[model samples]
Structures are given as structure tokens and as C-alpha cells.
Target: MKSLNLYIFLLLATLLGTSCENDGDRVVLSGFQEAELKATATNVVLSNENSGKLVFSLMWDAGQLQNTYSERYGISATALTTTLQFSTQNTFSEVKEVVETSSSKSYTGKALNSLALSLGLETGKAATIFIRLKSSIAANTQSLFSNVIELTVTPYEEIAFLYMPGDLSGGWDKYTTKVCSRAGNGEYEGFVEAAQWNNFKFTTEMSSTSGITYGSSPTDLYALDDSKDQWNIWFEEGGYFLIKANTNAMKWSKTAITGFYVTGEFNGWNPTVNAMTYDSAKKLWTVTCNITTTLYGIQILANGDWAMAYGDDNKNGELTLGGANIVINEPGTYTITMDLSNPEKYTYTIK
Candidate 1:
């Protein structure tokens, strides 16, 4: 029994010594080593090959790290984040960082264009782009940067307008020409008024006779055969209409508005109190009401609500939202006519 107890005590002492040694000894984890990154191409050129769109691709090799630190630190080398640092100068003074999260080394040129615009680079001008790559290893360590590459990109000119030069309102003049705004997907829209025997056509320029001109056909759209062959779209009777044209599908549509109203201080600012009647033959909203002598403003309200309301911006017949009130200094019977069919030339007459 004495020998057995002595053996048990020795075993306990050995175990305690082993535990103390382990407590004093620190287990160090290996960290990531510097990686050498190389790009497949040193320079890239971006062009508007695909309908004013350019795509950029970068192929690279990330060097091996020492000690398998990724596995030790619960990280994957493949999962490391990659980012592109872009700048106009080689010194990288105004650097913009764009992350490339995809496994593939591809980026769209549109992104580079946006960056260029942000950097004050003008469109249609060639600009040098300096770019470098950053690869992250661990959270605590610094990221590795690849060699810089220079790229030359020429952004395309963005065109966004279609003009209507017609004799509907008057002769083909700048004041009578209607400007149509682009609505994306090769579509343009605007409002125009037409009278019987009036002729008008779509043109790229307001005053010039050059460039593309659209004319009416039995089909959706057609090019004018010659300068004299301006096939104008006409209306049997004079009326106001909204016009929408799709250049891609070669189609057009028109919508006629039936009514609108004047509701404001003259009518207690109540939309439903008094309404204006539309004269289909005249293509105008006409109303004559008694107004108070007190200072009051009027607004044109459509469908008796604030959702669609127009006020005079300069009180000079031109209508726009958030405009100055149309005030009547003296109370009397007044005649008001609103012509809203032509968005480019909206007017309200007071008498």
C-alpha cells in the first residue's frame, strides 16, 4: 500500500509539472505573408463597341502566402476581397475605390464612365485612367496592391432630344417648334395642337433642314423622300393632343384631353365650387366668373384636385408648378381661358 501511494503521488506531480509547462508556453499563430499580384495586361482600352457601352476585364494572379495562415486564421484565400483603385493621375491623388466582388475579373465600362464624370472628365474626350488592385488577406493586416495600369477611354456623346418643327400653331419658327423629351427605350413624347389642313413633321433640328426628318405614312413612320416631301401629320378638326412616338417600333399614339378647370381664391380655393367647360371646337377651357376685389390668386386644377394644378411662374401667361399666384387686384367679372394641350407652350388668358 505504501509503494502504491508513492507511485500515485509521483504520477500526480508529473501531471502538475506538465500542466504548468503548458500554461507558461504560448502557442503562436502564423500570420499571412506578403503576396505578389500580377496583372495579365498592363493597359486597357475602352471603346463604344456595343451601342455606346464598353466592358472591361482584368485577369490576375495572386501569389502564394507562407505558413497556410488562411487555414490557421479560418479564412479562405479564394474568398479574399478584391478592389480597384482608380485615379486620373499616376500619383493617385483623387482615388476612387470600386469593389470587384465577383470571382470573374470583369467590369462594365459604364462604371468607368461614371467615375470619369465624377472626376470632371468631359464626355467625347479621351481621358487617361490609372487603376490598381487591392487584395485583402486578414482583418488585421494591410492589403496587397497590384501594379498600376493605365487606360484610355473616350466616352460617347449622349443625345436626348427630338424636335417638332411644324405649321400647326404657326409657320416653322423657333417659337412655334415643339421640343420632345426622351422617355428611354427609343421613345419620345410631347404635346401639340393641330388644326384642319395644318401640316407638321418631326425633325432633329429646330431651325435647320438637315439630319433625320420623320414623316407620316400608312405605316408607323417613314423618312422624308426629299426636302419638299415633308409628309406632315394633320388633324381633320382643330384639337389638342398628346403625342408619343417610339422610334424602335416605328409607332405613334395621340391622346386628346377633354377638360380642365380654374380653382383658387376666386372660388374660395375650392376645386369643386366652380368648374370650366371645354370647347372641343376651340380646344380651350373657358369660364367667366365673378371675382372679389380682395387680393387673391387663381390656379388651374385638372379633375378638381391639387394633383394636377398650374400657376403662372412669371404671371406672363406661362404656366408651371410652384409659380406665382394669378392675382386679381380688383373684383369684377373675368373671362379665363386655359390652353394646356401644348406642354412646350402652355398659356392662360385673363380678360
Candidate 2:
């Protein structure tokens, strides 16, 4: 009985010893022997034309730790987290965690372009970035790092947009659905007319299969959360509203609006005089204006205010938020069409 007890005690001690500093079986990463990082591409250029294509991939050797030979990759395989960081300087003065808890990290042209621009990298210009991997059981200890990799990538200019579709957006399949254009940095704004103010949510894309979907938080009504399935944003009643979304702040607001108006040099900038007519079938705002005189610069105003306004910045028919006023060259009663239907592209037409 004594020998049997002694054997069990020795077995436990051997197991405990094996759980710590190891000869090979359960080696606790000391954060000294660094991991090896491999990159698929070290140099490339990013453009909206190739935004969907994979730009590059960075992978690291996780050694036996990834194999999960034992529980507790420090504490356990589940506790080990790998983070991929981005930095412009080798010193990593400013670092951003691009990926987490992954052995490999990949970026597409769009993803990399957005990240580079968010990091203050100039568009269409070559810029160098450094990437490093960090594997740690916790924030303060047992961390393993990989050698840094350098990349030279050039990103392009692409204005981000958000899509809002619901009962108000012309049955959800029509091209006439109103779009919330990029108003400012991380901000979006649009004018929507809801007959019943039913269900609606924000999407990064028009489709349902992929892209991000943002909706009202389950806990807070005004706050927004990023989820594929979440609470649909609601309104108290059905009416015209100026919808605003700030992705950076993760909040959305719907301001009740009366209607849209055509305010320009022709009306002496009087927003209230020329009320634009809403065509329910076409889901657009239209007005037949008699420009007996030369009308230079016309702007579409929401709720008779500049809070949400659209004009042709380049005078090329396409509308822009707070853009330069649109000019009318021909003099006569002409139909001005304001189309806010397609997302990512808004335009106006003068007939």
C-alpha cells in the first residue's frame, strides 16, 4: 500500500514538472526565442479597381503551441491570442491591431487602402509600413513576438458610403432607394421619406450575403452595433426625416424633416419658395423651375436648411455633400431631377 501511494505521488510530481519549463512536450514560451514571420507580398499598390483582390498575407510559425499538444498554451490553447499590428515606423511609435488571434493575416486592396488612409498615409503615394506579430497568453506576460516585415504599398482615394433600406426605400429592390452620402469624416447623411416609418438598417453594401450590417443596439435605442442580425432601427411615426450616421461614434440619429426644396441663385437662396415635389413612383424629388434669367448655382436643401445639402461640386451633374452650387445655363421652365436612389453615387439632372 505504501509503495502504491508513493508511485501515485511521484506520478503527480512528474506531471507537474512536465507542465512547466519543458524539454519538448509542454514548452512554455519564454518570449525569448522569437517566431518566424513570412509574408506573401512585400511590395504592392492598392487601387479601388483591385480593391476586392487579396493584396498580401502575413503568416507566422506557431511551433507546437499551435498544435495544442497540451492544454495551457501557457494557460490553455484558448488563452493564447495572436495579434497583428501595423506601424509606419520601425519603432512602432503608433501601432494599430489589424488582426487578432490568428496565425495568418491577410488584407485586400480595399482593406489595406482604408487602413493606410486611416493611418494618415497619403493616397496614390508609395508608403512603407511595418508589421509584427504578437502572441501572448495575457497582456503582461508570456508573450512571443515575430520578426518585423516591411511593405511598400500605395493606396487610392475611395469615398466610403452606407446604405439604408427599408419600407421607405422604394420596396428595397428598386434603384431609387435613398442613400446616405458621406457628409464628413466617418459621417453619413441622407433624406428619407417613410410612409409608415417601418424597419430599416444600415449596410455597407446593398446585398445581403456579405458586408457589414449596423442596427440599433439591443440595450440602447440610439446607439448602433455592428452585427449581421441585430435590432432594426425604428421611428416613432412615418414621415420625412434626415437620417444621420456616425460610424466612428457608433450612433445614428433621425431628424424629422418637412420636405426638400430647391434653393439656388434663381430663388435668391430662398429655401422655402421652391418646394420640390416627391414622385412616389420614381422615388425622387423633382421641380419644374422657370429660369427666365440666368440661374447660377442651385443647391438641394433638406428641411429648408443647410444641415443636409447637395450640389454639383464639379458641375458635372453628380451631387456632392456641401458641394459647389449647380449652375443653369438654359433659360426656360425646365424639370430639375434630384436622384438619391443609388448608393455610392448621387446625381442631378436639368432638363
Candidate 3:
């Protein structure tokens, strides 16, 4: 009995010593539970009727490194972030991610439908989307990924656009409104065919009275005036022209390009021959020609004359006035395109 008691005492001492082995100033990752993402509904059909209503709400825990290990050892952790990922493809071939500091995110019917459509889902068709959460500390170490959740959603059709109507059609006819497209830099560009007058203005919608109208200010035709009483911008000459509004610089320019034609070996270097057709919608000139020579020269001239000529000097798909002849390799049929949208830079595409 004495020997057995002595043995038990030694065993208890050994266990106690082993427990205090890691009780020093060392910090280690003992264990952690990844952030789990949840949603209010796994299946929903977004509708226009319920456009204002909430479709679903996503909830996830804020990532913070405050585990028992941090408490055991005095150590401060940097800011942690949680990002939510959304993808229509099951394999997540393309993903749209949103970083959220809030614990919950809610989407309305219209918002969800727009998101679904933007993610390549068809309208009125049910498709599944994958969503998950990724959490990591400032160190970007020990990244924790949550389980992916699938949501089947049916979306509605919705399109947002701005159409400009002006007096280039002789009157304020919404039917003849010249559709203007805004670039990413807030500049508006469009084509207008004027017959005998150049009085024009931009409208925010198809109908002028229903939406906002932008017109000339007291400064000049280029300046914009934001008011109910707006003046129409006008000029003397009337022709097919391009109107560019630079809101950033508070200026505008009107350029007229009558026509473009190909003058090259294909047409015996005749500027008036092989008239290229102008694509009004795309604002480009395109032409197809047959080349009998493997190496030849081609030039794009204006007004069926050599008043303004462009050529590819370095064969780098760029145009320079009176540049070198463009070399053609391998005789075959090809389509050529001229892009003079930017007055400063001119480019061409041959395929």
C-alpha cells in the first residue's frame, strides 16, 4: 500500500509539470472556429412588384482575433476583415466580392434582381449562386474560409440608361432623339445629323419635359446651364456632326467628318474610289477589299481627295497624316476599319 501511494504521488507530479510546460510567455494558435455565413432565405424569386421589399438578408460574424490563446499571452491583434463573395458559376470562375464591416447585409427585390442579372443570370430563369465569407487578420495569415452556401434565385428584367433628345431633327421629336452615351469619365458623345439648322440640346430621358434638360448657359454654347428655363445651342452650318460634351472641363466641341474612302493599290491609289460606308451607331468607317498583291500600300483619305490623308507609318495600327504606306502581307480578302473617335489619337483595324 505504501509503494502504491508513492507511485500515485509521482504520477500526479509528472502530470502537473507537463501542464505548466506551455504556461510561459509563448503564444501559439490553439484552435479557431471559422466565420459561418447565413442567409434569411436559400431560395427566392425577385419580382418587380415587390421591388421595394427586402429579398434576403445575409449575416456573418465579425472576424476578430480574440481567442483563448490571445488571453493566455499578452498580445495585440491588428484589424481583421471579412469579405463576402458572390458568383453565379458553381466553380466560381468569376466572382464579385464586397467587403463588409457590418454583421448583416440586406438586399431589396430590385437590388437582388440587378445583382443577379449583372452576374450573368437570365431574366425569369432560376439559377443557383454560390456565396461564402473569407476572414483574415491584418497579417494576412491564417486565412479562414467559410462553407459555401447556394441560393437559387429567379430575377426580373431591369435596365437603366440615359437617352438625349435635341433639336437636330428640326423639332423636339422624341422619335428622332439622338441617343447619347456617357463614357466612364462623365463625358457624353453622340452623333447628330443636321439638315439646315444646328439648334440642339441634351435631354436626360426620351421625353424632354419628363426628365432633366441640359442647355446652354449665359457663357457660351459649350457651357451647360442646369435650370428649367434653358436655351438651345445653335450654330450657322448644318451637317452630319459629332457632339462631345466634356463636363469636367465645362466645354464642348463639334466636329464634322463628311466621309472617308480608301485610296490604295487595291483601287489603283484612287482617293475617290472604294467609298467606305460609315456606321453611324458605332461612329466608325469600315470597308472590305480584295488584295491581289502580298505587299502593298494603303491610305485612308477624306472628301474623295487628298486634302486629309492618313497612313500607318510604323504599321502599328495607328494613323498619321501622310504617313508611310501600310504593308499588306499574304494576299487575301480583308476588312478594314478606321476609328477617329479621339481627335488626338487615330487607330485602324484590319482583319
Candidate 4:
């Protein structure tokens, strides 16, 4: 019995020795090694999620023994839907799952810290959004942790136009002359100077039958073959005719305005044939005319120079030397002193 007891004691000693030997060589990491763990989650939804929720964790001892959790990414309890948990001895890390939704119609499961939200973007630059976070788990499990999450936002922009320069009131002018000839500057031309109003309203109607009549102005030296050959109509809708003075002369050309008849009758009687445009740069109002020689079927005893003989006021009387063959070459107002001594100056516009 003593030998059997000795053998059993030997067996027990051997077992204890073997166990100690195995344990001495084994390496176990509790809080001994550096506590560093990283956690990552896929499919993250930031909507309604706490911005500081755990997404990663790391732990490092500062002296005393304690468990702590920290992250390198922005964490939000709401940002993580799926979850993963890991630990570095004293540190805890987690990877979470999340779901993105298009609910609320206008609300998307994405960060909206950008300029696009502020200005209501149309079609320009793209806004930017980013999230960054830093967290430190407390040394004491019960102590409060230090965590931070940041968002950066930016807006987009582009170039655009507001308004253009032009007179809105002067829409367009369309005029037709007798014999189906066309007249007037319907479109703005670089060569022709624009007409200016002295005291007339731009919105007035110049189509009144009693206001003004159309006949050849003195500037138009050419005479029409027939009264029916000189009529001209102007289409200045929404605006009235305005005459501006040039720097050339002191007299403005005037049109012989007669009584108004219906449009058909007006068209039937070509009362005038001259249209003049002032060139501000050159200080001249150029006249355009078509003069035919078949008046009264007589090659009348008058100078071929259309202006001189017209001083015959009665149209039937013969020309007298007292009449001045007034030729205007500059920009200004002109008055025909046919009855010179009378000093009756007829006002005419050139510009």
C-alpha cells in the first residue's frame, strides 16, 4: 500500500509539473499588449443617426488598468444599421449595418451640408459634403468619453444674364410708299442715327387723320410725276414719329401735310415721295427721292434742278428771281422763304 501511494504521488507530481511547463511557454494577451482595434461597417445610413455612433475603436494604456473605446471615423447611433463588434483587450470596436431610404419625397438618406441647399441650385456647380470624426473611450468604463464629429459643406455657382439695352417703346417701324415702294428703317442700322422726340410722348398715336399729312419735304428736291405717285405710309406701332436735329444746318425740312382720307383713298393718291435719314457722325440728313417728269403733261419752262422752280407758290404762276434756290447740305432746321419779304418760315425736320 505504501508503494501504491508513492506511485500515485509521483503521477500527481508529474501531471502538475507538465501543466506548469505548458502554461509557462504559452502567450496570452489580456491587457498586456497594446489595445488597438478597428471596426468598419458597410451600407451606412446617416439619416436620423447620432453623429458620434461607434464605427471604429482603439485602446492604449496610459498607466493604470481600464477598458476604453475610441474611433477614427464619425460615429452616430443612427448612422449604423448593421453592426460588428471587436475588442483589443481593454478596448471595444464595432462595425454596424445601415439602410438608406428615399422617404419624405425630398429627403434622401445623405448628408445635406452643402451650398446647393442654401441657394436652391439650378444648373451650375456641385455642392460638397463630408464627415470626419474623432473619438476617445474613457479609461474608466463609467467615465464620460470624448467624441467629435464634423461636417464640411460647400455650394456651386455659374454665370448668367439679367437685362439687355434698347428702347422698349420703339418696337419697329414699317412704312410703304406709293407705287408699292418701301420706306423707313424697320431695324436699327449702324449708319442711320436714331430719331429723338423734343416734347412728344413716345406712346402717342401719330395716325390721326387731322394730326400730320404726308407730302414731299423741301429736302426732297425731286417732284412726283403724279400726286398719286408720292404717297407713303409708315408703320410705327406703339411709337410716334420723332425728328432729331443734326449739326449741319439751322433749318429743318417740313412736309406739306394735307387733309386725310380713308386708307384706300390715301393709297390711291401718292402725295409724297421723300424720306430723309440723319447721320449723326457725318452731320448730314441724306434724302432719297424718285422724281418723274410727267407733271401736267408739260415739259414746263422750269429749271431741271427740281428745287428752284417750286418757289412758284400758286403752282400755276411763273417763277420769279426773288425765289432763292435754297440748297441745304447740313444738319439743322430749314424754312422755305418763298415769300421772302413776308418772312414766313416753314419749319421742317431733317433728323
In model 2, which regions exceed 4 Å deviation?
1-35, 47-52, 62-76, 139-144, 158-258, 264-268, 279-281, 288-297, 307-309, 313-315, 328-334
lDDT of 3 by residue, 1-351 (tens): 323443443354455446756774323333234777889999999776877788888998655544334444322332455777788776777776666657787877755765565466777889998998877553425667788889999977644222444565546665354433222233556545565555767654456544335677766767765443357777667766666765334456777767778877767888777778877668688998887664567788867668568788888998876888777887778898987655335689989
In order of lDDT, best first, we have 2, 3, 1, 4
Which 10-residue window in model 1 sums to the lowest lDDT?
A: 220-229
* Residue 94 shift from truth in candidate 2, angstroms: 2.7
TM-score versus the correct structure, for each prediction: 0.37, 0.63, 0.40, 0.13
lDDT values of the candidates? 0.57, 0.68, 0.65, 0.23
lDDT of 1 by residue, 7-67 (tens): 4433544555466576673222233333233444434344445433435656655444333
| Candidate 2 residue lDDT tens string, 1-351 | 333443443355457558644655543233234668999988888876888887888888755333233344222344455667678889988776533445676666765665566456776789998988866554444577789999998877667666666665555542234444342245677666675547777766666543456778898878876642368887778876667777656788888867778876667888888888878668688888876656465788878888778788787889876988778776678888887655556788899
The residue-by-residue lDDT of candidate 4 on 146-256, one tens digit each, is 221122223222111101012322322311101100111111001111233211111111232211122222344221111212232122332212222111111112222
| lDDT for position 139 in model 2 | 44
Superposed by TM-score, candidate 2 places the C-alpha of residue 85 at a distance from the truth, in angstroms, of 1.4
Query: How well does candidate 3 match the true structure in TM-score terms?
Result: 0.40
Model 4 quality (TM-score): 0.13
Clashing pairs in 2: 72-75, 72-76
Q: What lDDT does candidate 4 reach at residue 230?
A: 27
